[model samples]
Target: MYISNVTIKNYRGFNNLKIKLSKLTVIIGENDTGKTNFLRALSLPLSNNSLDYNQKRLSVPDINSNCIKIFYKSIIEDEDQEIQLKKIPKVSVTIQFKDVKDFYETEIVHKWLTDADGEPCYEIRYDYKPKNDLDLLLNVKDMLKDCNASEESKWFTLPVEHYEYQIISSNNEKQISFNDLKHVVINTIPAERDDFSDSNSMKANNILTKLLVNTLDDSEKNNINSAYTEFFAAIEKTDTFKKILSSDADFENLKDYINQIECIPNLPNLRNILSNITLGYGDDFLYQKGLGERNLVFIFLLFAFYKSTQKSFNLCCIEEPESHLSINNLKLATDFIYKSVNKSNRLLQTILTTHNPTVINKLKINNVVAFNGTEAISLTDVSQNLLDYLRKRPNFDILKLLFADKVILVEGPSEEMLINTFIQTKVNSLNNVEVISIGHKGYKTFLDIWLRINKNNSAKKIGVVRDFDNQQKAKEDHDVYDAENENIVVRTTKEYTLEDDFVRAGDNCKILSELFGTEIDYDTVAQSMKANKTGGMLKICDAMLSPDKTFDLVLPSHIMEIVEKLK
Candidate 1:
């Protein structure tokens, strides 16, 4: 079974978010936009206390600040709105598992199944709320009301004092312990884990423990336990312990005061000793390796551990796997991850968050989820041909469009080059504005994404720039999306193309005339620009931005509209 969807409410960095996941999900978002929190959300319902150590007890700081503020606001508003105990906000997370076809998966989720007969799916939910006692809830509300009336506001102290966190199966709303869900294994390797100093040994130990889980099996562990038994006997057979026992006769009178107590090597459990195992690489230990090599080793170890161990379901979540690696190695790492997930058993699934563009190339667009703090937009329904077109060209940094507050998408390289030059030289500094080229007829897909991620958000603007091969169809394209979308401004060229519009825009032809340093007419320049679009546009851009001419460059009206909107 694999995670199909994740819903989070009032968790850290999110008021609410829901994203549909795939087998190999590549989450991309700017810093603090819920990419890291989305990975951490899985730890709530699918954690194994023996494995994951980042699982600290939930506290007030873990609650979303907005939810706390709203709770207080509801308590103070008019004093007549009947605030029920159930209406109090709760910080929660839900993970839904799908495709339970095999016996192993079915047995694990049978108790958690919402529907045992239909296409099988299961949900496990976690909630942090005040206890479900009616009298205690009433007392909690009274405390809040008293605090509100006396003006002694209890900051950062509302949810923790009276709240308890619980895990419940959605099938029958029955509470379950972490041990009950031991069949699910999830290991999250953080980004900053290369430091192996004494102070950072916890991080170092975490990586090693995960590696050991991949390296050792049940039989190997049993063999080690038996070997430890024999090894401890050998140490006890030495003369040191016999000397202490033989001296009992000499201290017979002292023995009456302090019975017979023998000194021996006192060690903890076998697993504790194994946890102290040190790995060496070359001359130094594994943790002592350089950053890039150590990180690559971590990836290899996680991959090995994820596939080696058998479980009902297995998941590996990584944050910024591209940390401290060269571009060439990043590509290899991404390719390795993609192929490993593809070739492994159906039980193995991997989810990772990355800021590096190369990490998404091999993973493809369909498996990527763009998280924007409050919502998630995925490319699951986008055309395969378009997704492949972007994947084949790594030069196209699609994450820029996802991260930008304002964007303008063009048809090809010519429009991209010309528009960027114009924006930089003329429009001053639009720091959050970006220009992306997605070829022709690719606006609908990204626009649909923009509409989803930016819905109910602040007025983040996006412009669509394309050529009008036919002017009548161009107006239809502009009017349809422009009227339907408040965040989008679709601007198509009035003439046949941007080049044709440039030839017709006032005094713009003179710049092109000076580009070749020849007496070329406007119509011929337009025709030649069409024949060689990128090269012709490059020369035009060079003349305009780095000019040796008397007059300034004048942008075409259609192009000016977009530039003006950007400004």
Candidate 2:
């Protein structure tokens, strides 16, 4: 079974985070918003990975920097008592599970339950503490007990050389570890790392080597070793070697200096020989392939290897799948990852953190989580038709709206182009707010994202800008998006369409009519725009780019309201 819940506190860049994980969970956010930190934090409690212990160990850097700052500030506030009862900042992560089955799974999760006698639960907890020993606080206070200004200034750096941490069972108040058993494993593939490079051997290649070691039994290994040893022993006795030796004997001084130098090839066995195998297209090995191609192949091979080898639950955390990938290759890689987990018989779970829109386009809405530093946003109860529609058509840039601080949704490309120009030129160029034209698929569906997120904290502002066929439809649109507390504002064109409204706006028709170099009124301009929407918008936008020209084409008040409100 997969891990259902993860609760994190004061680790890496994450101040605090709690999010339920789907079997194939995708975390999308801009860089350094704790997406990678979230992945690293989830890796703490998991065991049975090749480098999990070494990678999971806590250091001074592992503790949240802000938490450390507050800890240093809070320590010596009370001078007389040396230390008060303020709780020292500590980092802890607890992962709860669902769908746990079988004796070993039950036994493993049983030891790490949150409560012993209260309720049936399954969780694994890890904590990094401030006080490694009883006298830590007292000694720290005494060190800074009495010091001059100069001495005290130097002593402000009160961080630990190394922090002590432990994995403990909440059920029994005892230190615990899952390393002794290979029941569960977690493997992390980092972004921007050349794991398959020849200059630096991949640390993860050890897993492949270990798998080979386990696969071949002792007798088979012995036979392979014997064959290599015998072949090496026979090399010196060959006729070619005898002739070379005889020739060396004639050169007495050289032969005397050498005494005896025998050729000994490196012994090959199942254990270490796999590393020597050149993998890739014939001449170009894995290290020599293009970075993107190598990365895709590396990921594909990794998933296949895990699928074949894993018996217990396996969780693979991949960060930034779109690194160095072309569109086709990225599609293939993402498709493989999702399909391998869901369609296979093996228990392989994947959690991905990405900055790429293509990754989000390939995933289900329910499985994608927006990591906005406040709280993760996950789509729930979304219709199946919409979910499949997103995957089928990747052109919709839902990801841009997901990451923006504020959003402006419009009807078509004409509105998108014009509004963007209007914002950049007329307004002060509000950078945080984004304008996305959703092609008029459905306005309400896009609002569902803000609905899930604004529930917790209604800080994210969303402006829905669309055109109505009639004034009656505008009233219905207003009623649909009329959520005051939700921070959403709906603005529709006063007339039937954006073109109709634009023609009706003050001096906009005169300006466009002058630019078109012909006499045109509201009806002619509106009908022409409706027929050739992109063509009409492109001509106006192309002229707006020139610094020598200026057109006082006023926008509809409602359009400006959506843009300015989001701003």
Candidate 3:
């Protein structure tokens, strides 16, 4: 069974949020946007560990509501049956919580006792009244007096308040054990993992020992024990052992203690003998490696052991798997995570939270979830064609758009370099914005890219700066594009092209003539600028960088307007 959907309400930072799950889901967002909280909420129902909802997981806005509900839709497919007769059941598990004081009075508790919805509700309910005859009489003295009861008479009986807790399924309100849901296990690899820590090493050892115990049969265990006994006997016969027995005071004391016992212990138990074994490569321990290498080795050992044990799990939550990883290692880790989801005999779903573009770029765009502070917006809403186009375009770095506070979309490399320099020199306040050159694709294409990016990152400001190709045509069609989007700013120039605009803005012809060491007129320079656009722009950019000249005199007002809008 794998989770198909999760609904979280009254949980930390998530009042009412529902996110769809795929085989592999990549969650990306800015810091403190509830990415970690989202993962914690997912692990709650499937994890056996208890979470303190009131203190740590409760939403402040929902404190008055006094409850937190996390609902999951698990999809179970029956492959044992024929395809025509197969059943795919969508099971629902609702984990509800109420303050301890209101545990009994909560509506969810009441529903568990009386609701006939045929869905399981795991909650606490209670039945309370008076306890015993004397206690009941004392509690209801007026009723006892009305009934003519006395100390000699039989004391009236009444029920006392007591709580009952169970996992009540919808099937006739039958109680089921929470262990019945053990098939769905949630494992989390937190972001702050330290493989070299003593606790983590112990955990790894325990997991390895458990896997060994479970994988080996009794016959194999006995064979291993016999072999270990032979090795022990050989070691006892060694010269070193005799030397220790004769010279070491500790060995003499151990021998004396063993003689005092009724029966000396046989060979140490094989399981306990290897319990303290530490993994190492060659002569160096795994912990002695670099942090990044250790993280990779630890993660690999965990997943490899998990896969070898043939255990099934519903969901795996991995936070920042790219942490302390190089680009190649990050790719390897992400690929392993993706491949593990569709393993042959297991149903595993993975949820990953990452800031690394290497990981993000490797994932399918449709499986991405972008989290703002208030909500999670799925990038699957973007047109598949556009995503496909982006995938094919190697030069387009979508991470820049996703991570930047604002984006400036231009036409080509010349515009990119010039605008970036301009922003750096003139508009120092807008340092968080990125200048993206989307090639020579016209204003419509720039708008299309802007819209696509806005769909996923609507909170970010976008600026589209394109040259008006024809001055006469622009005058007739001033409303060619809508200027109504509050999050976007569209800037157009009245001049024929960027080159023409540069020439008109300042003494560009004079600058070009001085740079090229030739006498060039204004019209000739402007026309030649179009013939060698990149070369002309490079010359102008170099001039701007020179301490002898200042290009600020030619700064365009529309460019400044775009930067201001972004700010």
The residue-by-residue lDDT of candidate 3 on 302-418, one tens digit each, is 565555534444355678888899878877887886676556233456788988766766776678887766677677666666566567773367667655778887878877878
Q: TM-scores of the models, in the given order?
A: 0.84, 0.84, 0.69
Q: What C-alpha lDDT values do all the predictions have?
A: 0.73, 0.70, 0.57
lDDT of 2 by residue, 284-402 (tens): 66677788887887677666666665466778888888889998999999888878878864357888888777787777667788877667766656767667667666767776776
Least well predicted 10-residue stretch by lDDT in candidate 3: 68-77
Which ranking of candidates, highest lDDT first? Answer: 1, 2, 3
TM-score of 2: 0.84
- lDDT assessment of candidate 2: 0.70
Per-prediction CA RMSD (Å): 4.5, 4.7, 14.0
Off by over 4 Å in 1: 49-51, 78-82, 116-120, 132-155, 196-206, 213-276, 427-430, 440-442, 455-458, 528-532, 547-549
Q: Model 3 compared with the native: what TM-score?
A: 0.69
User: Number of clashes in model 1?
Assistant: 0
